[model samples]
Target: MSGSRPAATATAAAPARPGGGMRPGGPGGPFGGMAGPPQKPLNFGPSAKRLVGRLAPERLGVMLVVVLTVVSVALNAIGPRLLGHGTDLIFQGIIGRQLPEGVTRDQAVENLRADGQNTFADMITGMSVMPGQGIDFGALQSVLLGVLALYVGASLFMWLQAYLLNDIVQRTVFRLRSDVEDKIHRLPLKYFDVNARGDVLSRVTNDIDNVSQSLQQTLSQLLNSLLTVVGVLAMMLWISPLLALIALATIPLSLIITTLVAKRSQQQFVAQWAHTGALNGQIEEAYTGHALVKVFGRQREVEQSFGAKNDELFQASFGAQFVSGLIMPAMFFLGNLNYVAIAVVGGLRVASGTMTLGEVQAFVQYTRQFTQPLTQVASMANVLQSGVASAERVFELLDEPEQVPDSTDPATLDRQPRGRVEFEHVSFSYDPDQPLIEDLSLVAEPGRTVAIVGPTGAGKTTLVNLIMRFYELQGGRITIDGRDIAELSRDELRSNIGMVLQDTWLFGGTIRENLAYGDPTASEAQIRAAAEATYVDRFVHSLPGGYDTVIDEEGDNISAGEKQLLTIARAFLADPAILILDEATSSVDTRTEVLVQHAMAALRSDRTSFVIAHRLSTIRDADLILVMRDGAIVEQGSHTELLERRGAYFDLYNSQFALPAVEE
Candidate 1:
């Protein structure tokens, strides 16, 4: 996704919508909020071929599958031809078979009758045809046994093909999903500001699913169609060249029609997938923000928006299917026309003794067989195009630039962290035109609590973000422990700091697991001690399951204060050299806030702490205070110094802390 916040330019530069955004046919913008690394047109020429080739080296199973497919189709086709030959021989017997050069008509008739009877006898009583009208029942039984053997070969080959097809499709999908997942983890935090979670989720789930379905359905049809067309066409030529030529005449027309349908379907299918993604994103957004929707009484607005997207999906899907579905009936109609032409042309040739009835029968069957594969080829083209669309999306994500490169030249710090930080002439901006911290300079020594107080949008969080190197500064540098932060590995820099965010997020797992996330190696005793220190022990012990209790979907079962305390206990266990508390007590009651404040004070001993707060009481004991306005530091000094100056900090402290209360 784009590693920057969504700008108005993003909305304006987006492609035009189908019917002006009412249909899926509009510009490819279903994943509206989610940005991917920039996208390009879906190219399946050299790149697709190369990708398919790469897969080939690992496709041992596909090789075996192809072999089985060839064998099965060959056996199946030849078996029917042999059966038809036997039927022809029997019919010839019913008419007195024509004589050869040396044989009289009566003698030829006797010979044909004998061969026909021998073949039928073999089919029924198990005997082989002996020269000169002698037949053996034992040989006929052996022929029946041989039929079973042929069928066994076909069944075994079919099973092998099915197993391999499933394996290739599943393994390829697994690899693609793995790559998408890894990219998501590596993208910068700013990507989240532009994209919604639901939109990203749609790509990983719905888009990938479409690719898998296409692979599964199209691959099999591709093999069957190519082989069947070639095999049937060759057989037709062998049986009756004139009739085969007549049947072949229809191919160019059929191809033109198929090609047009595929092209139209491809465009519509792409729109269909785009609309599906947008609809999914809308549904996810509504579900995630159901409380907001209810509070604003905007349920009708949400429904209307969702309905529009859903309608686009329906229209695109219908258009694609309706156009593509034309291939079947058209093919069948053309095939029937060819059949009539072949019958009329070949029948006259047979009357003139140029071609036999058996050859004509075989030619007709071959024509039908050829058209069957062509029909399959046409039907499968739509699925192939859909897979191409999905592959484009998948590759788009893979090619995105990483936010933080894995440092190749990492700087090592001293054995112990001294907790000194310096921001030198640090000027930064989300946009270059609006500087958040223009030529700002600051320093914090070891074991000092620095408080940053500001009005909303005053760049307080931006300051902390820079210290953590979440975004590189535009015109300055930050030094941690006297070393440039950019030189330190991300892991090393992050490991030295702990943060408690305004929103406490917990995964769906046991309380013990969530607490242990801070320090996986911490002992049970240490965990309990941290909990007690943060006053989490009070509520945790009250629960029947205690630490064993499972948290559901961001800890909905626990009150906000309890969740904050749990997070605080978690950070306390980490014991970082620097701690960041961002509005950590904003959701708690007055009593809970006091308890949390006491716990935070104990945890702050001997650590470099940065507290972002609007509450004047929280920062009363801070060693230094920085009051900010509109992305710049307006005032800074010790609490007494700032109060004496009677500036922005002084006004903020009085407004927030001057209220009367019962004496504690």
Candidate 2:
């Protein structure tokens, strides 16, 4: 139960692996068997950018959102500048009240815009200048109204832009989730063996959440900050090029610090995600094994395991958040230093009579404005990085190669199948070096029963997997009625075959609903007939609601024997031309076994059938018995003929029947 996983191999033809260290399985084999792989340190970069590219199709909406964000930030930055203008106007009014300064009101307004200098500079420099103009109440009221209007407009635009930004992000995430689901279904079964289900779930749930949070909250803010920073810098230069040059010195330093911090934080966040997935998987495993834990009285041990995983998650999360949290404070500290520099330099200029008091005031206001955006951007760095990490995980899933692709020119199923099966020199293996079936061949004529008996791992299950086309044959081919299974449409081939697995899966629903799943077109009468054939009718009628009795999740509410009988009834409803019973009666008791045997007898009447069984008693009456060992047939004959040979089949049968069962 370690969090580490097997090293995933890269396929040049397949999609790229998500960022991580690679440590393939050791010399033993690639599958890793019981032991998991070594932990790989996760990275976040190229994969994240791939997600951005995936969102490119919606670029227009994203661009529109960016534009609105810039407008919002620009308006916000202009506020202080507008205030500076108002202050100059008030100061000019006071100067006008003094001895004539040779300035008209229009010229004063124009001068404030052009030079940000007022005639009052001489008075402040030891020349007793008198007031020029009295306070104009009407003008002051108009200025107040203008300020209110500008603030209101900016607020409205900020709200609108933020709304659009969130909308665009939500739409993109919705599509991303759907695409991931589709890709997961397309992935081969082999992929699942190497990857953790909990990890995949985390990517879809928590990672997607990160992306959404960045979009809704941080995305617009980041853009606004950038625009503010740039605009403020421009105005600062206009006010005092010397001070602006001094303030600009901090920009590169801040950028370098932010970049390094963001990169480190991103890597930590990726680890956090990995641990989160591990934690989720541990919880699922603990809960699933709760019965075993309680039976063994190991509740404390379970608790300890969970605590350890939770602590790992906590440590990783704290580090990531801590580093990300430093960015804002650092940015603000630099901003404050720049502010002090501007204030001191501007004061010197005013003292030397080189700059007017109004000009100095304007420069200080612009300098503060410029630093504001940098602070905002720095604060949102965590959200942006977290989103990028989540995006990478999601995109990786979507990029997995499809294991089963449609044929280049699929053949149409134009007629009903005759149910002839032939396995020609077919060989396969879960592990490439260990062939499960080696150049083995067999044929099942229409309406015949072909029973396959073998010890565990003799490739009995693997053989069935091929017939169902679950795994492609490594060599040779399987044909149905002279048509190669590969050439035939998967749907066409599978539609003709009905399967009853050893471990029957039952969805949460009424018995009738479960039966209907096999053939939705079946009538109630037909359903009852199928049930009766499988001896399921006896159990159904015993229930208070008969077919209406609800089966709990996984059919845990019912007995195993009853569940198997219901599955058989389901196959009957499908009325497939071919049937595969894989250990179909292994779980039933003696009495139930007899009833199930009757059902099997009826089922075998007019269809091609393949039976894989551990018990020799079930196949004693089979049309043909094939004994397989180590991927090849060791014996093939009728039950008596094989037993007479006293070979592998005889030894297998004698070993089982040799033991006498005690009465319950």
Candidate 3:
């Protein structure tokens, strides 16, 4: 028996992937994948900006981190200069101890210059040396202590900055998750119908985790490295502009490497995640329908699909990781080049006495600091690219068009309406090009059991969907008690209606909890009464826990009949004015079906109910049985009346209930 899911979902031309849904850091492949129309380009700039904007709520925290980092970087920048002074102190002290007594630094310099020791004279020219004084431990100790203090302050501020940055990144990611969750609820059912569930799930769980983890890994380091570069470069320029310029010469080369590698890596990362989603979708579909796959002997095809998807993931991940990985090593190589140039230039300057040994030492330190941060930023290219790709996926989901907002001042549906439902020239189509229902008008009188009988895709469920307002109508209106359903909020409208589909869904909870889901305010006696009415109490009383018996996720403990009974009981507890039953007894044995039918009769007492049944026997006693043919009511009457008319209903009845030909 086909359940009409395809036609019910109403998906027409959305480009949904074949299979679906984690990490692809690395294996073996070329450094790229198909980055064509299927995989849209990652909107790095906008996504990154939006990610940054998530920190708006924590602006104060961000400012604190920035301030703390600035202080740390400033202190770190001055540390080497202060350390250079300490070196100067030691050098001056040692030189003064060896010099003649009563001779001043200028006098020593003048004497050295007279002797043409010009470079040596220049080396100690600015040095505070005494001609005859020994190593002055007091002044040396003071300079050493001052350098130590600067370093300690720098470390303290850096630690504080790191501590605060973690908070900002986490909170920002938290808000992103919240936004994503809220966005999911607002999206239309068509969105889910058009996309694979696993893909959407990956966007929520995997993509979001990727975004969070990436931010945690890169945010602090990126901020610190970038600031460190600026701060360190400023110090390098102040110390020796020529050496700083030499160090900077490697920038263009580093940029070239990062840009080239990133271009290839970005595409691969996108493909990697896309493949991850595709793989997940396949896994979800296969696992959920595993029994059907085995019954149909399609296990091999499913396995091959999984294998292909996994291999694609491996290819993209390997490329994304391997290609992006090249940045760090390349950057380090340029840094080494920069490091060598700085050391050589500083040594020459020191030897020429144009710069002191201590000054050259500090300048060399500054060069390493500057190059190191650049290398760090370059190394982060892979992580940044992967993260931005994930963000793009998440943003795309958030940007999906949601259902129109509920009316601000919606009309209210009574707890117990008069129960007259009317479709005035209602027209709707799953796809506009292929209309399913035309200008069809029907009135379901109060307390009537309107049986909608049809073949699969004859819009049997579609009619029910219309009554429930699951999809908006393209023309005309549906009204209950003379009030348009569109004028009421969905929650308000749905609260007065109850539905029990063919497939029963029971969460992990006690029987009592499941019953209470129908109406939270139900009393113990009322719950038991409803359960007894649906015969759920008959089975539950035999179980050890009675109402307290916990249902597993799959509800394996309950028989199919028992599950149906519980659903009916749950619906009974709801006590809705209108009930919609979608062939609830279609799969049960005759004995169970009889019991279910009785319980359904009780549930439908004095209520307007729509029963979508494939079995013609079930709707025989209906007040009005509408025989539907491709979304139109071809005939409408009671079973006896339709049989007399010999119309579509008569044909359907004869097909299902007509006796077989007599044997020869």
Candidate 4:
């Protein structure tokens, strides 16, 4: 899943790779590129408890399900007893019919005892067998009907509980999804900067989905199985304690097998999800910069990296499934063994005449009931482990620190103040130890253009980020109209400023709508006017749909210059008090740039503008040009004044616009 995209560093001290650089742990680097290092699985008990706590809001629903399940299990437990009662009736009638018609039940038993048939006499004495009766049809019919009613009632209650459980689980997962979405928005931008975006997305989407599926599939069934075990065990003991012991003997073996298998599979399941997130991250990175990847001829390397991560995921998944899959077969084997033991013991008891055949039959039925639930529990071990693992990843995302809280009481500003910005002794660093911008002070008069010119990694973009409060300052303050910007709410401060970055981002909408995004309340005529001023109208009209041409998500339908023009048009539509243009015209050709420059002139006429540009010609008319190097202002003056000084700015200008050598 991994590919080469250079990560944000503590400081951009070196030139970035021309295209997205090859990611580390590629075929050329060390292994484990997909995910950093394998993480240990979260403790099962704590994670499972935390996951279960998500159902607290559905407490009432869960309680109802529990009650229904108990009712179902109780009713199911009564079935064997009614069946045993009916069996006794048939057995007694068959035995009684062969006895003398005048003989009492006690007389028949005594006769059998005198004939040295004590065990047979004991069996005969246990049932109410009338000597003349062949069968008790009336009692037998009532018992059979009772058994049917009990079984039907049990099934109905089970269905009701399952229906309610589905509702409760879905509600819980919905809330979980909501919480994760809110958390994603609230998280600090640095989290996205430092972490793999694909991994984060996988946790939010894929992990939560897995958790939902597992809960939906296994939660109710597991609950039912446990309750069934308890109810059936009690019934078994009631039928014959000796046979109940035989059924209980295999339970220890089932528990031991489940525990050992679950423990090993827990690590594999954790690995499976971790690899999934890493693979997702890689895929996202590769796709987002696929053009750059191909342009740089790193496709082979990226594919190798992807293949490695994918293989890791496959291994983890197979291992988890294979390990956990062992539990069910082992459980089934033990369950069958328990059945055989119970049947043999029950048969011996029935033959000894200590227990009737009817009792032995019911005991055998209880044996299956008891072991079946245990088998169910064992079978669910893999699901429970995988679900818990996915849930833990979700919890990790939810637990990430959020952005700093906004000021409780925000400062109010005038409807539209003259944009006078001042950076007073400001200092900032992406990392505290590596100071990028230190005590950088500047004053931008109202309705003035302050152009910042610098080499890459001179903190040009970082300075803009600081001004926007996208990041906090390490020292000093920036102010607007003599009021500290920190005192203003982020929304209010940002509303006064409009930014057009070098990169163009267009929505998947018509060109008209994209332009309207700069000011949602703008009228149609105003949107067209801005587009015309920035030359967006030129190419927009050339398209078949003109202003209504829908731009795709990537904006690939339009040329790069056209896309850049549209962004400029959108920024022009905003008409903010302070405007920022960071390499805003870089993508445009000379003719388009000339046209956009005129549009920019009109846009910045009344606003205080901060323009970060490398093309020295564009800033010749700027009121003041600040020359930055290694995050500090090395020179400051009007462009003409700097050129006259023949200092750092003069050297930079010559280096860029130096005339080409004549052909030899």
Candidate 5:
């Protein structure tokens, strides 16, 4: 099968003629039946900005998180310095005990003060008065307790930050999902015509899921990691500017590597998600048409197609993961090198008396802390890229064009319409370069049955789309009861017309509920009356639940003909001024069709009805028969009158009976 196999099969199975059946480029059209080519990766700059903008409503919360993160990191950075102070106090006490007996306490203090170490001596002196005494255990205990208190405070702030950020992320995702749902309803039908159902679903389900997960997991970690890096670097500089410079040397190289790897990996991430969506689309299409695939014995073809898409997704996913995986290990090696350099340099500084042993140990700890955040950032690379890619897909969908705006001063039907409809010189084309319907004019007076007949691809269903305002006409005016349809709201206009399509759609509900869909306020007696008129009450009564029988999704619990009858009954219940029966009896048995014809005749006695059917035998009693060819009405008149005229209608009528072709 070709890539367009689904489209061709749908077209052959149920062709949409002018105003009668499904249109070619309407919902579930050939163009949208299958997934198209993969979309290119979106620009990261714009997508990121838009995502940030979506969180504008929670700016105050975000600001509080940032403040808490900063404070938490600052406390964590100061803890090491405080521990170093305890180490210094112990070293001073040990050395003071070893001081020569002849050296006085004042001399020792003055000597240390001259060496620019007055702060250390003063702290130790306050705890220890005797010069030859051992270390001051009390001072050591005090410094250790202070460090513990600082750590506890830091943990509290971190917890608060996490809590606030989580709320922000969840609320943002909620708003985003709501916007997508609203946008789906507002978008024009043409958007669906060119987009696959599964692909659109992927954006709503998988893509949004990715975005939400990434934000929830990555946002807090990202903020904490960044603040930790900055705080560690600042403390390192405060201890010794020279050692801080040495630690900073590895940063430029690590960043260059991270940037190169991230750039390559981002593209793969985008491709991976796109292929995932395509695979989902294929799965949805295949499963929805499983019976058809088996009937045609094309299971192998379907399997091969699925395998191809699956493989593509796997390759893209692997490439993205492998490239991003390189970042952590590479940064780890760089971090180790920085640690070694800082240890050696700090040892040399301690020996030269430029730094204390405690200070050297603290500086080394800070260097380790600095590299840890970089590793964390590297670990988050995959999540961040995936999230941005998903956000791009969602935003693209949200940006789709909606239906044409309603008129500012719209017209309304002054009273209940008498079921008169007119098409005045209407012109339209799905593709502007290929004109379909041109300068067509027609009128259906109240209580008229107008039958439209045409061959395949003759724009039969397109007329119904135009009449329902599913597609705007290029040039023309369609009026109901002398008022232009364009001037009336679509909801009001559609509510006044009832349609029974070739494909019967019944939701998963009780039979009564399905019947009441056309008129929710319909009484139970009225519902039974409508069902009885269309012969639906017979099968419905035979079921165990009768009118309360449950129908599964797709209404597969009932036979196709029974489903069709139910839809016809629904139309009867609606009782609109104008009624459309597009191949309504196609699935029913001959006997059932005859019964339905009788019911329809009575229903049409007081309404304008348009019947589209391929079976010439069924529409012989139509008051007006329109023979359409190449989008234009070639002949139209009463069934007998058209037969006598022997025009386009005669040829179509005779051809159906397998009679000799008659010249128009």
Candidate 6:
């Protein structure tokens, strides 16, 4: 986001349209005038890797999570095996030969050893059973208790992992948001000029939110699921390699299906978010300009346009969700097929005495565990892809080109500035092929008014932008107090100048807060003095809350003229050596304009002032008047001097006084 505003030369070749081609009064213009261009899909692998790199600062927490996940998965994997051992003990006790009543346990064990049933006798002895009893209920109870402990421990570790991961993910999101905020201040104004306000806001708010949510919900689950799959596969192989191979056969099929679905779903997810941003842009534009829509009878048109965008969002979201939704069920079906194959093959192995019945049960359990994580991973594909897409958007914003670098060794004003401004042979163009302000030269000594009068698109605003260093000059230099502006830091240069634009901007704050914005350290006496000078104190006193009145975001609590006066008061409070008034009085009533002019005259008495006005009558007494046409100074002189010459300024001044004749 470059800081410089594009020059008028770039817009000259464009077709002439109202509101600069913004669809101001129709359905197509709902998204703050014009819909932004389509977005391209982001690369998933690189984006995901970049997102992971952002977590590098939390390495300790991530390592802890990895350890906990491995421990938990190991415990879970051991549970079924332990249960199977308990089952084997119970089966042995049930099938073991019965002994004579009251036979000594040692004698029964010796008899069983003689009968080739020594293992069962040993089991009976371990349980303290007298062999008269059939099953070793005591030993079975101990094995069950061990299995319960494993499960409980696994649950506890999983809980701890979730807690730690949440902390890390939240902290990472905090850093990302902070970086975005800082980047916003550094971005050039040109970025904003070409981008939608709501779209940029979407990246800052919606995209970041998506990234946070997905990381919180999916990151830990993804890790745990993958670990579980690996652990289960290892356990299965330990039980029986053949069964393990059969179970593993389903993996490639699942991967093939998941990859295809994920590819299609990711594309849809990207589109879904893009349309969502567009809809948000539309809502912001419609709501911000609600009054204009109603006054222009464009309410129906706006609604129709909004509905179209809303429908697009619906389709894209539905497509993404529906495609990703197929993953779990498909994995489940494959899992069930694998389970059947394992059960049949393992039953044969059990019959052939190659594996015990207890081991077969454990192997089947391991197979289920293996498929479960795959299913879970498949289920999370949607979230992961959406998160990656969102991350791509956020990284794209952070990657925008910043403002031009400041000079390494900057120059400063040698003494207090006298407001002497000079534009020496300054040449510039938004595009290299078409020059706008070519070889322009001007000088305004201290305490003089330079009034610039021009037709629309005559580069009046561009000239002021150049003076303020909002845009760098393509050639030559601008100097203030004989110091080149390019050599001065933007902050230092702008601090010495004050501007009150035609569009008054006031944040959502008390009137007093807005007045004190230019100089926060201003005393109450100074604040009141500035307000009184601009005649804003009259209205301030009239309001029920006085200066403390809370203005809304749009500052609609006050009339346009009152808002203008408050801005004037703000500029006056700054007391800069140079001031810019861009049609500052154009929106005020005649009485209010007269008062403001009086205040402005006093303010300009000791400062270099540049006034751009459409109404020529107000600038009659300007120290020097410049008449501009086609991006050039056609005539420049004092009011009387220009009128006597009867050139462009004469024709322009005379046209305003011309009256309509009565029609026959």
CA shift of 393, model 3, Å: 1.1
| True-vs-predicted CA distance for residue 11, candidate 1, Å | 26
Go through the candidates in order and give each one's C-alpha lDDT: 0.72, 0.73, 0.79, 0.83, 0.83, 0.83
In candidate 1, what residue range of length 10 has the lowest lDDT sum? 1-10
In order of listing, the candidates' clash counts read: 8, 9, 12, 2, 9, 4
C-alpha lDDT of candidate 5 relative to the true structure: 0.83
Model 4 worst lDDT window (10 residues) = 1-10
- Tens digit of per-residue lDDT, candidate 4, span 417-448: 79888887787776655677777777888899
Residue range 221-330, candidate 1, lDDT tens digits: 78867877777777777777778789899999999998777767767766776666667767776776677679889888778877777787799889878887888888
Ranking by TM-score: 4, 3, 6, 5, 2, 1
Task: Give one digit per residue, the lDDT tens place, for model 3 in 3-36.
Answer: 1111122223221111101111111111112122
Q: Candidate 4: misplaced stretches above 4 Å?
A: 1-34, 98-100, 114-119, 660-664
Error of 1 at 127 (Å): 23
lDDT of 6 at 437: 75
lDDT of 6 by residue, 546-573 (tens): 9999999988889989999989899999
Higher lDDT: candidate 2 or 6? 6
Runs in model 3 with CA error above 4 Å? Answer: 1-37, 97-102, 106-119, 132-134, 659-664
For each candidate in turn, give its C-alpha RMSD to the true structure in angstroms.
7.9, 8.1, 5.7, 5.4, 6.6, 5.1
Who is ahead in lDDT, 2 or 4?
Answer: 4
| Model 4, position 323: C-alpha lDDT score | 98
350-416 per-residue lDDT for model 5 (tens digits): 6555777778788878887898888899989889888999999999899988888678888887557
TM-score of 5: 0.88
Model 1 reaches what TM-score against the true structure?
A: 0.84
Give each model a TM-score. Answer: 0.84, 0.84, 0.91, 0.91, 0.88, 0.90
